[model samples]
Target: MVSLSRVPQFTYQKLVHKIGSVDVLWFQHNSLDPELLMPKALFEVEHTTDIQNSLLKFQELRWFFVKMFIVADNKRRTEFAEKMKYSAFSELRNNKRVEFVSYDQLVGQYNMVSAQPSVSLLL
Candidate 1:
């Protein structure tokens, strides 16, 4: 169940406002609260945009429990590392709250997961 910008009866209104319009936001449906949803992760796909902007967005939502990922080409890994050194981003860096995922790695991971047999296949 994927939604864009908004989710039907989402429970995290405050969080959504704070996060603004992130590239992707993963959520899990709450069985106990069927009408509401909980955020699981946040992903920012920066193919050519400034990496610091995405980092700043993550910084603002640092206290939240959601995982944060910056997806870009492998060549940008160094830039991501270098930007993390700034004092404004120290806490997130030191705590390892954010991660960098190469575009290839992300696709590979998706492929690998997709190749897995469905649970129903065993039945």
Candidate 2:
């Protein structure tokens, strides 16, 4: 289950891009582990906001490449807290709320790049 404490109050301006994928296999394959120490919602949200805004100023195409994906481990709540320190994405990568779409028909044209949130502006 997702730890509500770690769920941040996502802001519109902070969201760079919104990725819409309906592939369950891809999520399962690429999903990172959950953190142990679930960070406070405030902390996660702030981090996410900072991460999002930071990526908006880039003009190069190479920024699109994902350097690394974070996965939380079995340390429980603490794991999440620890992961947050190293998270490199615009939003917190919590496993619980990680949207899982099994059917492409429900979403868009089955494309992975429909409305992806901007992720190229992180440090």
Candidate 3:
């Protein structure tokens, strides 16, 4: 279940399947019909926890259209690559169903977006 406290922007109640709790999930809602909402992306932030645990969760939800990402420290990129070589994760690796986002990359993106002026204000 997604916690409303984490995403206060969402006012409508959306249904998410029980694929275990993810660190962060982005949902796409139809503007015409707010009731129609679907998962757009899934992110797992692995700082101290085992990376394999996050991969296992992503493996189970690979069938969905949602984009999957594993966020971790840049130093762990090699660990991620090594784990992706495992036979069990062959499907995810071969198909490129998942991506890795380093903490620095994530923060950089956030900062870039924050630096941009709002379109509404510009208008």
Candidate 4:
């Protein structure tokens, strides 16, 4: 199994105060789909933090395309999603490539995550 902590390139995005929530973004990519993965990591974060921030160091990332995703599971997640929608602006209406799937959907792809968050990601 791949241990995230071992991956030196990965970093955490900053926390933004959009609504009433505090969100943290993590950058990741699918090696098989380098182009799509690279860009995905770019807009993944939009905040600044004392800890390592992924979005802030997007320039250092060397990949093809970009894709962004959110990671919030508590009461603040809704605000994060809303902020994403607001940020997309025109893309939200004109584009059809982006999607916002539940974390469960992601786990199902690998057969590692269940319907419940606690059970998913093998946490």
Full-model lDDT for every candidate? 0.82, 0.26, 0.75, 0.34
Task: Say which candidate scores most in lDDT.
Answer: 1
Candidate 3 structure quality by residue, lDDT tens digits, 72-106 = 99999999999999898998998998889998888
lDDT of 4 by residue, 40-59 (tens): 23223222332123222322
| Runs with alpha carbons beyond 4 Å of true place in candidate 3 | 1-17, 117-123
RMSD of each: 4.2, 18.0, 5.8, 10.0
Per-residue lDDT for 1-123 in model 2, tens only?
Answer: 232322232223232222111001111122343432212111111222333332222211113322222222223234334434455522434323221122232234334334554422121
Tell me how candidate 3 scores on lDDT. Answer: 0.75
Candidate order by lDDT, decreasing, is 1, 3, 4, 2
Q: Choose 1 or 2, whichever is better by lDDT.
A: 1
On TM-score, the candidate that comes out on top is 1
**Where does the lowest 10-residue lDDT sum fall in candidate 2?**
19-28
By TM-score: ranked, best first: 1, 3, 4, 2
Candidate 2 residue spans exceeding 4 A from truth = 1-74, 93-123
User: What residue pairs clash in candidate 3, if any at all?
Assistant: none
TM per candidate comes to: 0.84, 0.16, 0.78, 0.31
